[model samples]
Target: MNSQHAQHSPEILVFDSSDALASAAAQRLAAAIVSAQSDRGVARIALTGGSTGIAALRALRTVGDPIDWGRVEIFWGDDRFLPAGHEDRNDAQADEALLSHVPVDAARVFRMPCDEGEFAGDATAGARAYEETLRSLTPDGKIPELDVHLLGMGPDGHINSLFPGKATLSERERAVVAEFDSPKPPPQRITLTFPVVNAARHVWFLVAGADKAPAVAKAVGRASPADYPAAGAQGRDGTTWFLDKNAAELLR
Candidate 1:
């Protein structure tokens, strides 16, 4: 949250194994939460879904609870526009991973709308309602700048459902959008646009496995956002790529 670490230009932290990566990320996240809350009295974080992301969250539960979960505002970067309790929903996975283990205030956890909610199966309305909810959190009617935006890079250089070659990658104004034809299954999804994601104070890309090596390379290489959406996740304060050995192979 604060620029306390040495400035090493868009840092990359590599770990030996996926479990170790998860542990280190959990510790780093705890530090950020403590630092932000100490400086601002509240910390805002955007959570991500996916194997590695959920693993880190579960690891967060293993660390001593240094964060005042009550004062922390929790949000998701993207979510499947399905029923609230659907197994594939990001919020459900997150809750199962860590949120349910903490004493975080229910009101502070902002989840995207679902098929059964007031928005009811309308992904566009879900996106609009989530954006409005974000705006209401600040006095300026703008999306809140997250202290930490935890994300996972997909095999296709995607971040938060903003897949490669998708129209959402070209968006510059909206803070959030509903995607109707994601390359992955359960096509409908609601995602925070690049404008909101890149505006965060910190962005941590939690990636693992050899399957992501190529995409990681493209994300750090000379590629447009249209071709590698993950490239657009450059945070305002700092951006860190947390990778396991397999994922870091190409870069090495």
Candidate 2:
């Protein structure tokens, strides 16, 4: 890897293989969770949906060291407004791919409610409720101050439910928002707004594949937030982008 690749990668580490990347990320995130417990006696983390994010969760299951399951709270960065068992629901995916294998408390796992009749209303309610949950968990009303936020970037530069050219891109106050007309499939979704996403003590973006080359290039190369939503996504204390060879190919 060259200087630019080194610069744009995650703060603590990066990997080439999907499994290796996942394992490393999970271990680091777990370590962060443990550290949070040592420092403040509690840890709160936000998780994203998609293959990469799922893989990270899967990695957590096999981690050698034990995590303080009771002290940690898991929340989603975004979710598809589908029924509980729907294939596209982030909540379902997380449960199948990760939550099922962990020791996390059932009550502490905050998932968006999409089974209700009203999609928009459900999304709005879910966002507000998650915000309130975070408020109760945090010593203060602010977000991102918790331990860590694990994210996965789409090929088009979307992160969480915040897509390019969408109104959620500019959200400032609310921790979460209901997004509509997303270009990606399953258009209707709810996501943590930029304010919440960026408020974390640590933010990590796991991006891979040739399909993501263009977005990765624009994100770190041009540093234009609007053109590349990932560029705008940052952690309160720090932000890192993890990529494989193919994704980093266009960084020049």
Candidate 3:
């Protein structure tokens, strides 16, 4: 199960319960983002969508802290290619959970525009537009070496919109691409390709529950990238995996 890509394996942290772990991770993530902004003047982060990710967001809100929300630029790792207000939109979930609760400058919050009446229903155009935005803001021609990229793992080892054995998993050139035929459903999505995701400075995965244990073992045990898409996710600078007892039960 050895993988060269795992050179970025993160410091693993395990907790007793999902709620406690997600909450703590969220608070730490908020603090980390704030600290990065203080040290570097700006911090760009990629966020995920799911119950676990939402729990982490809720933890951020419950924990008392005054972050320089204005200096933080938020991005999504992937999104459902639905209308902005759609329940399945990652943007919508994030806004409800944390974004709307903060005072971040509206201009700094980069959400893909799904409402545009472009052919192919605007997903491709949105992805390309987001790539352009990244180009305009990043110091180099590369995608922003994001301060942090937060993610959640599906029971089957999926992350963002990239599912195991899917053709989208092989994409490299596009920072983001429109995903179709997803194994999870609501097939159409837009996601940050591996090249873009692996470009980040730090990537943290938050996971919980026994249902996700097998995939967790796969991810942590050096499973092949094709069968376990989570194995393909790596942070250029560092990577970390946060797990609860149930999810980490199989890890020897």
Candidate 2, residues 1-252, lDDT tens digits: the string is 011121234353446776777777888887888888989887888888878788888888878766888877888888887777798887788888888877788988887767465543566776677677767764766553646888888888888888887777877777778876878878778788777766677788887788988998787764656667887766666777777777777775
What TM-score does candidate 3 reach? 0.92
Candidate 1's displacement at residue 45, Å, is: 0.5
The C-alpha stretches of model 2 lying farther than 4 A from their native spots are 1-14, 117-121
Model 3, 21-83: lDDT tens per residue?
888888888788877888899888888998888889878887766678899899999888877
lDDT value for model 3: 0.82
- Between candidates 1 and 2, which one is better according to TM-score? 1
The Cα RMSD in angstroms, rounded to one decimal, for candidate 3 relative to the true structure is: 2.7
lDDT of 1 by residue, 117-220 (tens): 58886899999989999999999897898999999988889999899888887787788899999889899999998888877889999999999999888777
Between candidates 1 and 3, the one scoring higher on lDDT is: 1
